[model samples]
Target: MPSPFILSGCSGGGKSSVLDELKDRGFTVVPEAGRRVVADALQTNSNALPWIDPLAFCRACCDLHMQDLAKLPNQERRVFLDRSLIDLFAYLEMKRISVPADLGAALRAVSYAKTVFLTPPWQQIFVNDQERKASFKEAALEYEHLLSSYRSLGYQVTLLPKTSVADRTDMLLNELDQMDA
Candidate 1:
């Protein structure tokens, strides 16, 4: 399986936009699991929400992420993932929820690209939606947690510039090109 290149950071930090841009540029991409999980819960009126039951919510997100990872085709091309399994741990930390041992083990087992692209808190582009309810302050805190989590896992975290989507995509593609070189 191709090792995924992860774009992870605070919600509303334009990670999704970057993923979209990458997709447009013909790269395989994985959508954020948490957004899909939350949207499904809301649609089904389930209690698996972050604010309602963070553990359950995180578990669902992780399951989705694992499923997505399992479906990735084995190839040489790099797949761009909006987030990875480690994001669950970061979310649990930010929410002050206990991280399950199984979750930790899973995080240790799963692998991605050695370098992760991290989008810092961009207040100008940050906004709340149905799936993203975290305030800018909360988002910033989450960004810090993600930074720590990814670094602790020994992945090199490259901070994406707080710039336009096109500029960010150009920067990311350029970095990937250098990696290929």
Candidate 2:
């Protein structure tokens, strides 16, 4: 199976918007695991949130990502994911928390496409929401850490240009097409 293309980067960036456009275009798109984890924890009134318990949050998100990867069934079609296990490693490093052995193993075993798209931090677009609470500064820090992490892992990290959502989406699709060619 072909490796999935991942869209991961600064919080509050336009990653979600591009993913929405991709989904609307009928391509397979995996939502961000962190958002899903937060949504689930909120439903159960659990404190397993990023701000409450980051390690637990990372574990939950890792589990969700693994499950989603196992369930996704496309041998030839392109798949785009908002984030993956790689983010877990970066997050742990950022928090100065040691990664568990199991997580470390998964991070090594799982891989995405060599080229990963990252939404760079845009101050004007950053905002705190119920799910995304990180400030722009924090998001930028996370983005830098994640970029370094991916590069160290041997993926070509592509920064999505700061532009309108439509243009960004078009750029992603066009580049993906070119990559396929």
Candidate 3:
């Protein structure tokens, strides 16, 4: 089985930066599903839908995740994920959106990453990117939710140590190396 690696954390927790580093290290990486779905929804339905069709958005996001999963090459032994199915649960829980049974089961079937790289919220690095909508507080809540979701699902999550980006890169790689030993 490919080593599924999830980079889970708040929006401003340097998740994207981590993705960049991992990609530089020659690991195949999957982008976040939420931003992509939301962007497409905005372009198509200007009047409404996303605000009203929370379930639909969640479904779309789930489908995107599945697509990402399917796109992974079988020959690859390790792949980095920007987020995971657990985020869908977190998004629904935060938005008070109901999850469908099929979606829930699919999420349950998603084998979580052996090592979940989590970057804690850093207010300094946190900025209002074009895609970012949630406030720091809200992101923090979502971050907590993501952590709980993974733990609840029994994943062996590894919180990225508080260090420079380069250090974090080395730390994560070293941790994985140790795990493989």
lDDT of 2 by residue, 27-72 (tens): 8999888999999999999887988998899989989999999888
lDDT of 3 by residue, 129-170 (tens): 545777899888888888887787777778886667778888
lDDT score, candidate 3 = 0.79
> Model-by-model lDDT, in order?
0.90, 0.89, 0.79
Q: What is the lDDT of residue 123 in candidate 3?
A: 76
Query: What TM-score do all the candidates reach, one by one?
Result: 0.96, 0.95, 0.90
Q: Candidate 2: lDDT over CA atoms?
A: 0.89
Report the C-alpha displacement of residue 44, candidate 2, in angstroms.
1.2
TM-score of 3: 0.90
The runs of at least 3 residues in candidate 3 whose Cα sits more than 4 Å from the true structure, single-residue gaps closed, are 46-52
TM-score for candidate 2, please give it.
0.95
* Cα RMSD for candidates in order: 1.1, 1.2, 2.0
The better-scoring model by TM-score among 1 and 3 is 1
lDDT of model 2, residue 114: 90
> What range of 10 consecutive residues in model 2 has the weakest lDDT sum?
104-113
Model 1 segments more than 4 A misplaced:
none
Which pairs of residues clash in candidate 1, taking residues 3 or more apart in a chain or in different chains? none
